[model samples]
Target: MKTTAPRDQSRFAPDTASNGSVSPKNLLIAVDDSNATTRALQYVGRLLRETPNVSITLFHVLNPMPRELMEHGGSENPDMEHQLGEQLRKDQQEWMHMEETLEYPILERALERLRDTGFPTDRVTLKLGYAGDVVDTILDEVRSGGYGTLVVTRHGPPGAARLFSSSIADRLSRDLSGIALWVIE
Candidate 1:
C-alpha cells in the first residue's frame, strides 16, 4: 500500500467569478454604525485574510426623514408653517452632512481592520445609498453592483432589535433568492 501526503483542498477550491479569467471575489457587506456591523466586518476580514484576488465593498444605506414631516408647509398658520419648513430644511441639510462626515470614519476603520488581516487596501471600496426603504435600496445596490456575496449582521442599530427581531435578515434572505446572503449572529 502506498501512503501519500494529503493535498490541501482549500488551495484547490474554486471560487466564483463572472468570467473564466480570475476576477476578484467581490463581496458586499451591509454596514451601519452598530457594534454588530463592526463585528461582522471583523469576522469576514479574518476569514478571507489569505483569499487571493478578493475584494470587499462596504455598503451603507441611509434613510432620510419622511416627506410627511415637511408636509406641514401647507398648514393653516402661514408663519408657523414657514418656521416648520425652515426647520425641516435645516434637518435635511444636517442629515446630509452626517452622511458625508460620519460614514467616512466608519468605513476607514473597517478598511483598517481588513488591512490588519492582510487584505490589500486597494481592493476595498465603499458605497453609500439612500432611500426610504432600506431593504429595497440594498437589493438595488446588489443587483447593480454584481456582488458575489452579501453579508449583514442579525441585528441593526441598538434600538432596532426590539422592532425587527431578525425581520430584516429574514426578508433579505427570502427576497435575494439567487444571491449569497450571510447573516452573522
Candidate 2:
C-alpha cells in the first residue's frame, strides 16, 4: 500500500536549499510509547532543528497473533478453525479498540511534547503492523516512501537485550541502504 503523507507537517521548519529552494527530507521514527522511544523522538527533534528539510514518521507495530495461535494447531476441522479465526478477529478488534482509547492518549501526549519542542505535527507519521516484522515493513516503506533517515530508540543497559531482540533496528541497519539509523539512549 502507498504510504500517505502525515497530516501535521506544518509544525516543523520548512525545507530550503542552499540556493534558496525547497529540499525536503524524510525521517522515519520507530516508536512504541516506551520511555526509550520518547527519548529517540526528542533526539530526532533536536536533529531536525539542526538540519532542515526533514520529515519525521512515528511508527508503531501491533502484533496480531494470539497466544492460542501457538497452542492450537492448524486442525483439519473447518468448523473449529473457523471458530478460532473468529475468536482471533474479536481479540484483535478489542486490542485495537483498547489501543485507540488508551494508548492513543499517551501517543498524543508524546506528539504534543514534540510539538512543544518545535517538531511539526505534520511531519509525524503513525503506522501499525506486526511487532516482529516491523523492521521489514519499515524498510519497505522507507524505500517506497523515500525516507532519508530512520530514528530508532535503544533501551538502556538493563533492557538493551530485550529491545535488541524485539526491535527492528539491527536488521534495518544491516539491510536498508541509503538511510541513516540513529539509535537513541
Candidate 3:
C-alpha cells in the first residue's frame, strides 16, 4: 500500500502562517514603593533585557478620597457644607498639584531602576489612575489597556493579619484569570 500526503501542509507549519509577524508583548507592572515591587521590576528588567518586541507600562493606582469624606470633610455641622465644599475644592487642587509633582518621582525612580537593569527606556511608559478599590482598578487597567501580562508584588500584611484578611495578590490571582499574571513574593 502507498501513502498520500495532504495538499494543504500550511496548518502543520505554524510559524510560517505569517511571515515576519511580530506579536509584541505588552507587560503591565503594578507597583508601589515597596521592596517586593522593586524585586518584581528587577526580575522583569533582567528577564526582558535582551528580549525584543516587548514593551512595559508601569502602572500605579491611587486611591481617591471617599465620597462621604468629600461631602463633609469629616465635619458634623450641616452649616459646614459650604466650608466642606470649599475644602473639597482645595483638596482636589492639591491632588492635581501632587499628581504633577509627586507622581513624577515615583515613575522616574522606576524608570531609572529599569534602565540600570538594562531595559530600554523607549519601550517603557508610566500610567497613573485613580480609584477607590485597588484590585478593581488594576483589573480594569488590564482589560482596558490590552496588556498581555500583569506583574505584581506581594503586598499582603505580615503574619497573623494576612490569615484574617485577604491580600490584593490573592484577589488578583482569583479574579484575573484571562490575563497572564506574574506575582513576585
Candidate 4:
C-alpha cells in the first residue's frame, strides 16, 4: 500500500535553482528498507508535493563487515584467514546479487509513490554501497550530480521515543559542506 504525509506550509520557500528557469533540485533520500528509511521517503514525498521543481533520489547502503573482525585474526587455521577472505568475497557477491534482484522492484515502487504524489521520474537515483561509506558516496554524488539538498530519516525503530545515532550520518553532517541536510523523524 502507498503512504503519504502532509506538505510543509511555511511561507518561506528555499531557492532550488542554481541557474534561472526553475531547474529541478536533486534530493537524496537514504534508504535501508528499514521503517525509518520508509518514513524518510514518505517525508520526502510530502516535501516534494509542496515544493515545485524538485526531484528525489533513493539511496541504500549495505551494512559493512566489522572492522575489528577484519583487523584481528579470529580463525585457528592458517588457511582459515584465506578461507574467511574468500567467504567475505562470496558474501559480498551474494549481497550484490540480492541487490540486483531487488533494485528494480524497489525503485519501481518508489517511483510510483513519488509520481502519484506529483514528483518527476527524471530526478530519481538508486545507489548501493557499504553503509559505513554511504556519506562519502552521497557527497561524491552531490558534487558530481549537483544536488542541492539531502533528505535523510532520523534512525529510530518503530514506537521508539528517541532517534538513534548513525555514525555515517554524523560523519557526513560534520565533514560535508555546501549542501542542505534534512533529517526527518
lDDT of each: 0.66, 0.58, 0.67, 0.57
lDDT of 1: 0.66
Give lDDT tens digits, candidate 4, residues 1-185: 22211121122222345552222476666665556666666667766776665656565444454554344444878798788878777776666566555554554555566666655555555554344556776676555555677766667566553222366567768876777887666
Ten residues in a row with the worst lDDT in model 1? 1-10
The best-first sequence of candidates by lDDT reads 3, 1, 2, 4
Q: For residues 56-99, write the lDDT of model 1, one tens digit per residue.
A: 77766655556765455467888888988898788877766666
Model 3 lDDT on a 0 to 1 scale: 0.67
Q: Which has the greatest TM-score?
A: 3
**Which segments of candidate 1 are over 4 A away from where they belong?**
1-24, 66-95, 157-165
TM-score of each: 0.68, 0.64, 0.70, 0.58
| Tens digits of lDDT, candidate 3, 10-92 | 22221211343322387888877666667778999999988996778777665465565455445677668778788888877
Q: Candidate 2: where is the Cα deviation over 4 Å? A: 1-24, 50-53, 69-87, 99-102, 156-168
Task: Report per-prediction Cα RMSD to one decimal.
Answer: 12.2, 6.8, 14.5, 9.4
Considering lDDT, which of the candidate structures 1 and 2 is the better prediction for this target?
1
